[model samples]
Target: MSQKKTVYIGPFIQCKTLTDLDICPNGMIGVDEGGRIAFVLRDERGRKIPEGDGWEDAKIVRIQDHGFFFPGFIDTHIHAPQYPNAGIFGKSTLLDWLNTYTFPLESSFADLATASRIYNRVVARTLSHGTTTACYYATVHVPATNLLADICQTRGQRAFVGRVCMHEMSPEYYRDESVETALRDSKACIEHVRKIDPEFDLVTPIITPRFALSCNTESLAALGKLHRELDLPAQTHISENPRECDLVRDLFPESKSYADVYESAGLLTPKMILAHAIHLTEEETALIRARDAKISHCPASNTALTSGRAKVRKMLNAGLNLGLGTDVSGGYTSSILAEAREAVFVSRHVAMDEGDEAKLSVEEALYLATRGGAKVVGLEDRIGGFEVGKMWDAQMIGLEAVGPETTELDQSAGPVEVFGKETWDDLVAKWVYTGDDRSTTAVWVGGRLVHAKEGFRL
Candidate 1:
């Protein structure tokens, strides 16, 4: 039998937060396509197994002088077309931004070169932030959107790129093909980019109707039918800004709420992803969660744009499948760490004001950024957590340089060399509260090194 390479990450932290903080040791994790604790044990014993089926011939991989490795961060919502204008479009609230800056900027994507440049920057920035997978929204230009899929496929990043459809009610500069044309473009875009690499696993297409206001019922219905027919995921904004929600109510008065508008059009299914689900009523929340639709809690974006805070704790208690998203341009950062931190912050503020004070915690925020985001994008079992039999998409955060006094670890680490022997929870807490892209020294996807801080080559 041929030999398959064996890799051992030693003395590194694993988020043993899954099974038992008691059973998990701060030792090692072995990763191939899937992670196995047995592999880690063998490596600690100085055994170098073969790369393939011939385990006797395997060679051991030792990563020297680094910190812990955990599952790669996932961003449940981002806009590839808005990368360039990230901080520039922060002038106004949602609708105003959409009309003035966002619409004009997105209109530029019709130029393939422009799209290529922007998409390249978007991919690099997200990767640099240790986001191995992202659910991205592209402009209404189908060709430009497909260019995004191509870039993601080549980069070996797992992504869901949506070809946005806007057949009516958007600013002239941003609206796209008519209902029939939007449907056709979405279909063509999906079929064209379904397979790029041999594995045909990197890129997937999603149908993105801009929103209830931008899409006529006919267009949304057609997109919904296409969503069900192709078994593709559907994503879009909903109840983000109070004004936007008002406009949606005005447009779809026959519906009960923004969520109902989508439901009436047959788009409220389990695979649908709704971004910025703030301002949703209790009934609306119940309806969306009932259908198993997921919410991408973009706390930074909501707060930065002056949109009201989402009741994330309430949604969680309602049993909603929720995840964290950077929402990039609006969020002002690409790091999912920032997402987690802000999720905890905003949820606590909301909970303090509305719900009980015990609603939000740092651990819950971390869950949203990691496992929750993975599940929302339909990649939970494959990409999230350090569980066995899951794809090896993870990042190593080097917190050895951080002082325990700088963090909550002051209480946990006692008097010893605080950074020397840290637990998975210690590493995670540092990453969420104190770390950023700068803190991520190494990253891996599918068991292959993608980004390293001046170490191994990609």
Candidate 2:
């Protein structure tokens, strides 16, 4: 079946690098049948469309005055089953919150029906926020975990689904029964995802050992070995909370630090994505950088749980790949735009404690939400940004306008307002600070229209 070729003409904005954002007031992008971006014409400058190159018959989508095309967000780390528990944690920090809110809800996933309802909503909700790619942590139940992958595939979102491996320090009823069961069940989920998406073009299975405190040595080692054997990307938590760090120290006395636990278990590698590294030591940062491992900076979750601010500037200075995560339920929001705003605020907190050098600019934060996240999930070449040859994962962002003939109906264009005088940079800043999912008028993944608001036609 041949796919249709579409040409999108609009104002395009994207992070060109860590410090620069490329904004083309008049741009044209061509996406081929296979969902890959085939050509990008920046600032076409009144040139007519090239004819006899198969572009004459292509479908053209033109943007309105108030809207622009931006690359879709990438959520580097999120808990799929925790959607129901979002914003319910009351004064409970890491360990207690896990026992009270996280575990019980995740355990209910043994009932596949309940899992389906939650997984479906989370996938849809994240897609509405323009998250085209996500790295998801599913529960220990293999069926439910596989269902999560299936839901993402059906919803047309890119995802990495993992069956969490936690064989110790968790409630007996909810945890994996043994090391063998943990490995076996994890393998089953991985194979299920493989069978569903043979080439893993849209969905892949990740090795997830819940965290050092939840898993024993044997299970961690086995999961690491599986990570090596299958050459899969792995995700886990590290140094999220001070007490969690203390517990890791006590649990693995032989290891030098919390990061050492994974390093000693043979789990630290370039393919690993470690979440919430808020309180890592100098040596730990060096170790992670040396291993070429990536970090998912979950600022919203860290602040919500009263976890200390992560030194993102330090991590970036150390040459570590960093990305944003909703850490939903803990973070209390599904939108990566919210995460990007939170990232700015979190860096300010760091700057207050450790000078202005610790701060992060809006451009850097947006980069983390897109390009940096692509690196975290090991999809640097496939997703993120508006480059030719990358997948067409993007969103249409519309901002409101205040004019002389303004009426009540015109006020519904979301929180961002354009006075018709702001620069492109200022417009992006307004979107970052005030825009919500409402600003995401439409979303597309792999060049397919996946979500659109009312009045937004494909």
Candidate 3:
């Protein structure tokens, strides 16, 4: 396939701000040969195409009335190795779930063949669901973790692949031997990703400490220091469950609080991505905002594991950067759309306890999936939404129509039903409430057709 300059004309929808969505019913976006948006033409009734040097030969793709262009999803935190174990957590919370399900499955990556099989499926599945960029947690095995980076590069999904680091408090068979060995293996994986994608354009390495309970003081400090030395993004869990919080308190008695454990180790930097801040104190929230660190709200995982609902409305009001995460296995679903739905539900639950101001609207949840996620992964300038100079990471969503005459073939489009009398807002609301991966007819990353449904072609 030729990576030529192309023009996409269609009804496009994207979050213009945290509370508002920019729905361009008729728009055109020009993508250059390098896959960046070169020009954008907003709603202009029957306007003629402007002829210029490169615009003269641009291929044009027009979206049908039933479809619209949307920014691809970004999963800020997910365990790629635990994909197979998704939905298997039975009546277990964070700590017990790790021992019963997570550890045993992650330890199986010692076999290179097994790692390749699982990693391949994970990348393909996420892309199929329109996850253009993902922050992945690979197992501690260096070779397996490196294999994940290689697979993402080959498959053309933008990703941050991290080799998990845990030098203490983990199962004896799966844990890293020592602080030196953990650092060495982590460096090896980082170097491997750098070699494969030298500029770190598509795939980058992230420092992952697992969590406070998984690592000792020495390992946490060493990883934090390495994070600064390499200037890489870091991700870890914090304040997910009451038991996990109690364990961190017991483990780091010298620290004032759970957040202080990471703060004292120098891990609370702007590039840090702390997942599941469900039980953060006012002091911790202030500290996180001061450091400019981001949060990944894994709503589905939290509910499934019986973790407390994160005060998302509070976090947004505090000027904290936040995004959605699947937290697979614990989350039970890899779809960010599902996470967006869960986010809305979780916010409603918060509202029931703390009043109406705590509720999150659909616009806010979708924002967390795209723009917010881009910021969390440190790629805000590159892949969030449709704008000149941004990469063309987008999905084509098609909804089924239910009118006087409806065919079975039309119903195959998905669960969302449009009845011609609906406005653009109604259509989008229907999508949010009832849509699934089946509604995603086509997906693109960097102007490349990464996934397409059977009847859809670009």
Candidate 3 regions exceeding 4 Å error are: 407-411
Which TM-score value belongs to model 2?
A: 0.98
TM-score of 1: 0.88
Higher-ranked by TM-score: 1 or 2: 2
Ranking by lDDT: 3, 2, 1
Please give each candidate's TM-score.
0.88, 0.98, 0.98
Model 1 C-alpha lDDT per residue in residues 277-309, reported as the tens digit of each score: 999899998899789999999998998889989
User: Cα lDDT of all candidates, in order?
Assistant: 0.76, 0.92, 0.92
lDDT of 3 by residue, 104-186 (tens): 99999999999999999999999988899999999999999999999998898999999999867779999999999999999
Clashing pairs in 2: 86-329
TM-score of 3: 0.98
Candidate 2: segments with Cα more than 4 A from true spot: 407-411
After best superposition, candidate 2 residue 39: deviation in angstroms?
0.9
Runs of candidate 1 with Cα error greater than 4 angstroms are 1-4, 11-23, 33-52, 56-63, 197-200, 355-359, 402-424, 456-458
